[model samples]
Target: MPLVETAFQVVDAFTDKAFAGNPAAVMILEKFPADDILFKISREFNLSETAFIVPKYEGSTHEFHLRWFTPTAEVPLCGHATLASSHVLFTQMTEKQRQSGPLRFHTLSGELSVEFKTAAPEKLSTRNEMSLPELVMTPDLSIDRNVLCDAFGITENQILFVGSCHWGVLVEIDASTTPLHAIKPNFKAIASVNASAILLATQCGTDLHGEYDFISRMFAPNLGVNEDPVCGSAHSVLAHYYANKLKKSEFKAFQASARGGEIHVVYDAVAGRVRIAGDAVTVSKGVIYM
Candidate 1:
């Protein structure tokens, strides 16, 4: 087999500083290789997700094509990778593309948009905004509480609410009693929870004086990721789920993984889309010869 060398960059998404948020390896290819090849490259990077981008003029909001792959599978939507891609485009691409308006990425999840918020470099991190995937309630979806308890290492009483969507399952835990970030899940038991679910995200609200409005952690053992540092796609579910429960539509969310990150989320009911905004920084640049 002939070895193909693909240039790649790794960027930590959803954080202004390096090594804080989720890291995604990005490859800007002329055209995508076969799926098996993509999987092999993703597995080598061993990150939560790798984003593949191709420049094209086919779509309505066309500047680039986007896709996300985990070590084990290709996911339909990924927020942090998208953030990293946007960071690459604005900072590394030609000046013309940077000056161009909000970028429209043709993805498996459909047309998603991301734009640089400011012309100045210093304030750019405040506004790398991307309109993300929508949320859905999988009606009548059920998972055993004991199964969840075993997977997350929490008692049945700590599981406050359980909900499912096409993307993953969302659970509200009682942070008032148990410290939300202190709970360490049993990764080996995650696969035993539910075969249908791909990701498991747990969340809780902060006190009145807390730094953030809400805090969450995501796990996707089925997808070969024990914990996702800062999950953008999961926030699409969290934003709406908490909105209905808290009777609000916007928030500052914290992902409580060891490599923490902050996200600003807005649930735009009128448009039926969730807007997740965060900052991304490039940590390293390299090439992967596949």
Candidate 2:
């Protein structure tokens, strides 16, 4: 096959500094490539997620079509990657388009909107509104508490709440007693479990209690991400989980990964949507020939 050239940019989402948040590669293509090609490209990048975007013409409602792919499989929704995609698009746009209202994206999860925070790239941020995910506990399908602790390398006393959500099993640690950032998960064992994914969180303790409201980390061995540095989509579930636990709709959240990042979240029960807001920084721009 003849090689085709595609433009790409790597952006760190949910942070103002480069290489600090979730790193996602955005491939700006002229048209959709074969599924095999997309998969291979994602694997080649070997990042947590890669976003593919192209101009759309279905209607005046949407300006572009966006898709997200992990190293192993395609996903219906991805938060950090979506934010990175918006950063790339906003930077590439003409001053006129940049001045327009929020850009609309057609995606598998549904139509998403991202408005530029300001005209400057450094001031740019993304506000993604998504339907809140169900965070109900499934006692029958849930793994034993002990087993989950073993997989995450934590003690029984260290955990506070364990349940199931739309993304996977949601576990909340007692950060007051133990540190959330010190956890080292057994990824192989996590993948062997029945759950499709796992999300662990903790309400910030003395260390970050005042600085941030909550902290979290996501693991999806089945999806080729052992620990997602910063997951934006997962926050939709967090927004609902914390809203019920904390009795509030607004929160400042931090992802407790090595490359940590923060997100500002607001959940509107009546609207049935979680609005996640955060900044993004472009790290590199290049062309991918394939």
Candidate 3:
């Protein structure tokens, strides 16, 4: 039998420097392999997420068909991996192919588009902006506040249930008193929640970084990750929350995980979507022989 091989790139999303942001394995294939193989590859990589891409023949926003898989299962949406995939397309594809216009991706969540902006002639880095569907969450009236607080090892006053989306609950913490990084969550207890994951956010204090408006941390034990270094999907939900709170359309956010990264968000009320911009750097590439 002829050996089958595919090329893959590992990118650090939401960061200019390597090893500081969420790392994602991006596989660009002529045709998608079997579902089992995808799962195996994702499990083998053991990253927060892995993305598979194949060219799309037709659709309004159908330049490519994209899918995301975690170690455990496939998810409807993923922000950093999507950003990483966009980085690969914008930087790796032929310059002529990239000059056409905005790149559109057909995803399970919906049709997503990424626009690339030409950088200054002197600048070496390229900038890409992605418009993602704003995920609005509603108050989760079912969860007990006490249990929720216990799960995060915080008091009731320190935590508030902002809302719940398809992925899970959004909880806001008072960073004024407790910094986002100080809280230690009981992953076992957090996993007991009915929701898919828990998003904890806090207002950035002066003691914290000044450039950022807020800092956040994502825990999705349900998805097999203790903490996501940088999560794009969660920020889609966070963007709306902060925009309304601060009455500002644009925001700078930091995910304060061990591997920290920055993300810029702009809310487009006219389109009802949030535009997320970030930097991604390719760390390495290799061929996967199956």
Q: What is the lDDT for 231 in model 2?
A: 90
lDDT of 1 by residue, 16-51 (tens): 777788999988888888999999989999999999
Best model number under lDDT: 3
Question: Which digits, one per residue and each the tens of the lDDT, describe model 2 over residues 1-290?
Answer: 98777788888898878779899999877689899999998998999999998878643323788999998898888888888888887776676776677777788877887766643455444433333332444433356877877788878887777777456778877766556777788888788877667888888663354588888889999999888999988888788888888899999988889999989898887766777878787888888888
| Model 2 segments more than 4 A misplaced | 58-62, 122-141, 206-209
Worst 10 residues of 1 by lDDT: 200-209
TM-score of 1: 0.90
**Candidate models: Cα lDDT each:** 0.78, 0.79, 0.83
lDDT-superior candidate, 2 or 3 = 3
My TM-score estimates for the predictions, one after another, are 0.90, 0.90, 0.93
Colliding residue pairs in candidate 3: none
Runs with alpha carbons beyond 4 Å of true place in candidate 3: 58-62, 118-125
By TM-score, the candidates rank as 3, 2, 1
Provide C-alpha RMSD values for all models, in order.
2.9, 2.6, 2.5
State the number of backbone clashes in model 1.
0
Candidate 3 C-alpha lDDT tens digits along 216-247: 99999888888999999898899888888888
